[model samples]
Target chain A: MTTTSTAPLGDITGSEAALRGFLAGLPGVDQVGAEARAAMLASRSVKTSAKSYAVDLAISMIDLTTLEGADTAGKVRALAAKALRPDPSDPGCPSVAAVCVYPDLAGTARAALGNSTGHSRVQVASVATAFPSGRASLETKLRDTAEAVAAGADEIDMVIDRGAFLSGHEGRVLDEIVAVKQACRGPGAGRGGEVHLKVILETGELGTYDNVRRASWLAMLAGADFIKTSTGKVQPAATLPVTLVMLEAVRDFRAATGRQVGVKAAGGIRASKDAVRYLVMVNEVTGGDWLDPRWFRFGASGLLNDLLLQRQKLATGHYSGPDHVTLD
Target chain B: MTADRPGDRLTVRKTFKLYIGGAFPRSESGRSFVVRDAEGRFWANAAQASRKDARDAVVAARTAQPGWAARAPYLRGQVLYRVAEVLEGRKAQFAAEVGRGEGLAAPRAEEVVDAAIDRWVWYAGWADKVGQVLGGANPVAGPYFNLSTPEPTGVVAVVAPQESSLLGLVSVVAPVVATGNTVVVIASERVPLPAVTLAEVLATSDVPGGVVNLLTGRVAEIAPWLASHLDVDALDLTGAGGADSDEPTGQLAGELEAAAAENLKRVRRPPVVPEDWTADPGMDRLRWTLEIKTVWHPVGV
Candidate 1:
């Protein structure tokens, strides 16, 4: 009854040789095929009861992020507040998975989440490893992860050095991911308590689906709890095609190693319709296991209000406007 | 019918495609319905545009609205004038298409084409002047100044008149875009050939991509979406209840209005019967899609 794509890994712990070999021998993705699959999945219709469920699911999966240079403690607090109750008027609205902030603001978000009257289900996720660019050395990167973890980040999102990955420095990317994973597991200063590690490939910077697929495998094999599509920095960040390739990789990786990894498609996904399409893709590609907030996430700030509006529409049976929703 | 003719030359058919973001594409559904000439002969297979197509067109129109709206009023006028010039150049081809599509005689078809081109010219002339006439500074009793200025209401969706074909379609679309608004226009269902040709003229003109995306399909099938789409700010249902429309037409328009209410969209309900497309499409068309914003400022030393 177990149907899967690609060969099974059984109980093998994909070591450097196996990891490298598995990655190197990883079948190249057909560009047109991947794109076509994404497009087809995007067209799946989810309406009425299903739509209500999806809008809530998408809102729940959002990482309510504010990663701007002008980010302040007040801003993080407001964002954390919104994360806990996206629609203040409607108590039925589910809280977001986490409030993502810079390493410095993780403490701010954590404090805000703690002080807020709402149930503190919302986690504080921080972008580490020099974020967007990942240009720093390993020591700086590890310290960055440790800093966010120490500052009360429940999840650590680390961006890979795309420059290295593109130039065939796979070992460097894998080593950094492993070290960052360890940094998240610290009490070693566990103030944050086993911060989940999310490896961001910044797929827009990675040239092709082949590189994206290889990067996905490399991150998962090196122990990424979640394989994220983008840093929300590059131009073509978190495209459906790229996400589709990554989702397929995770699906295959799980079939092989029996170790399930989550997938996060972040950036450029603004509207409820677009988010719904991504959910549909997840449902068909990864099935129900990855549907929860713990696995999937949308890294966006503007996206929350729209989801709130859509959620309100489902509640009131009429479309809601921007005036009705609180702006974070 | 031509099976008996052994040496007949194969007729070359033009594939009618949907114009979205200035690019001609077949419907995402890839399903097309046969559009016949007035004589009931197959004219062409117009793309049976789906909800997805309507959504895509709105996205395009939304994307282009800001840049198009920000253009200098005089520049927008000139660009619209350029569109008229393109249409004028293709007048002969358009006339022939309209003649066959609407079952009109050559002379009447030519007149319709002329009127359509002139309609564009009229709207183009209004682009720079409408704001001046519609907006003004309001004198305040207190030591303050208030100014009311007309702004384009972003993306507007138009269900083009099915009766008049070219002339009616042009009349509805030109005014919407003239006031800085971008539009996703649905062509006349039975007579879409001329509108498709008009789209070709628009694509070649200075109209930015997405400023005037065109979809050729049954309006009833596609309009519910544009009405419900949250991104679309205004809607012109001029083509909704034409002369050939039946009892359900009124209900359809009602449903559209109801859907538009979800977003509190500005809905323009046409007369029960199609308006005579050849008539002067006055300031009302332009006025419907324009938002008047009044700004108040304190008059301090």
Candidate 2:
């Protein structure tokens, strides 16, 4: 059966008018009915259970702000140590997906992870283009992206110039994005050396749901492998509402263009519950494909401990404070 | 089947104009564009609103916000409901216009027009009640009593939807005003005639001046101005989709969102599908309209 392209307005008019008239006559401030209340409660429970299971069963970490001043060698060694040491008792203690560090530290991370015995699982990602505050020139940004990828960074996180964007310089932003993506393309040794580019929206600075949606689409159209929320430098980074808005944008973009792009809610996400909420949003908004560590990674410094605590709570039927969990 | 019966036959047409401060006016630029039927017949010449026209509309919406928002909720609902009444009276004209422009059957066009008008009436009732539903006292662990209520976010710049021209424009404008915010709407570029007629209805109805202003022009030309306009408090780009492959709408949305950030202007992205119009209103509208107002009174009193 073919779907009708045109709907006759007259046919729907009677129903529309009756509905409108009824709505018009009714009191504006009526209480929500019991059915709706019950449905809301059930949905809330479903959402919470869905989120908890997602966080407990499968969720990975992407530690971006960890290798602050560390050199390439130190960062790689750190990543190798983390990747090789998964807890034996906890089935949920999967190794992290990647270790995100500064561009200069990409080679060290790559070599450490690649050469370590029984530790080729972790990928090395690099932040390029005057990250945290993307105020650099396009040429320098492009160069930064190329240098990082050439140095064995599998993924590149580039920040959009919030100042330029706010100034209504859309063409410039698009051009920068295109140039960086072009720089990251190439052929690797056995497989393609094509680096996944995560466009950092720095949503805290963008300030509104509308802007977040717009930026999410723009990045996706400009060839973003993943759309990231924040650089984690500023306050109010990575909010649930903001992530919800971005995920909606991804879903909309996919529906519009048939392209499935990933989302990364980085920065200010420190708790297992917060991670669970992000996971819930991703699952609900984009579905199960995004539930994996390969697609979704929490850019966090203190998130692992919280995840461990939640896991412990689930196992022992008792909640434990931060003191009981081990530190990295 | 009746021969020589002129009474059985019908003709439909529309006239498009710019709506400003509750008045229907031709574009200040004195430019007009012809909208044609699917058979390539001339239907109407719509006002080609200019940058100056957009800025002027913004001025009108800004000037009228405080008073319109201050009006009693029930009174505001009554006025908005009156708009629906006027629209219902002219439903035939809207149906005919849409039928010719969209190449749809008369009956189909009538349904679209009726749905659009009814959408206005629905939101009109929401004018007063949306506040009570979306906002309330926050459960804070503090001594200070805090109540959050919905408030107009001031003048908004809106880009009406392209495909469902009249319905899309009404769907956006009604919600913005239902919560007391004034708007400057940029009508659909390809089919703008119905928007102007709706503006006429608003003028005749008791809609406060500048509560809603309509612009008819190239969205690309006018959108940047509205997005970058420093005075505008929020933007709704629900109609930025074009036939072009580049999707300039997304780029425009980003630019405007970033620009709005300077003053923390609320922004609502364009809906991907027309169904989004009838779907549950996202938090975007609520977030934009609701404000955290902390009322203080002497506890002793």
Best by lDDT: 1
User: Over all chains combined, what TM-score does candidate 2 have?
Assistant: 0.44
Expressed as tens digits, the lDDT of each residue in A49-95 for candidate 2 is: 55456554433555534646535465457555665443445755667
Question: Model 1: which residue pairs collide?
Answer: A9-A256, A187-A190
Candidate 1, residue B247: how far the Cα is off, in Å: 5.4
- Estimate, for each residue in A31-131, the C-alpha lDDT of model 1 and write its tens digit: 99888988888878888899999999999899989889998899888887888888788888888889999999988898898833333468888999998
lDDT of each: 0.85, 0.71
Residue ranges of candidate 2 with Cα displaced over 4 Å: A1-328, B1-15, B242-249, B273-287, B296-298
TM-score of chain B of each: 0.94, 0.87
RMSD in order of candidates: 5.0, 25.9
For B1-301, candidate 2 gives per-residue lDDT tens digits of: 6647767665554457788887778888899888767688876788888877886787788789889989988899999999999999999989987887767898889888888887888888887787677777766665656677677778888888776678777877888887888899988777777787788889888998899898888887788777766668788876764332126447766775676665566777755544445545444553565565656433343
TM-score of every candidate: 0.81, 0.44
Model 2: how far is A26 from its true place, Å? Answer: 76
What does the lDDT read for residue B235 in candidate 2? 83
Residue B185 lDDT, candidate 2, scale 0-100: 90
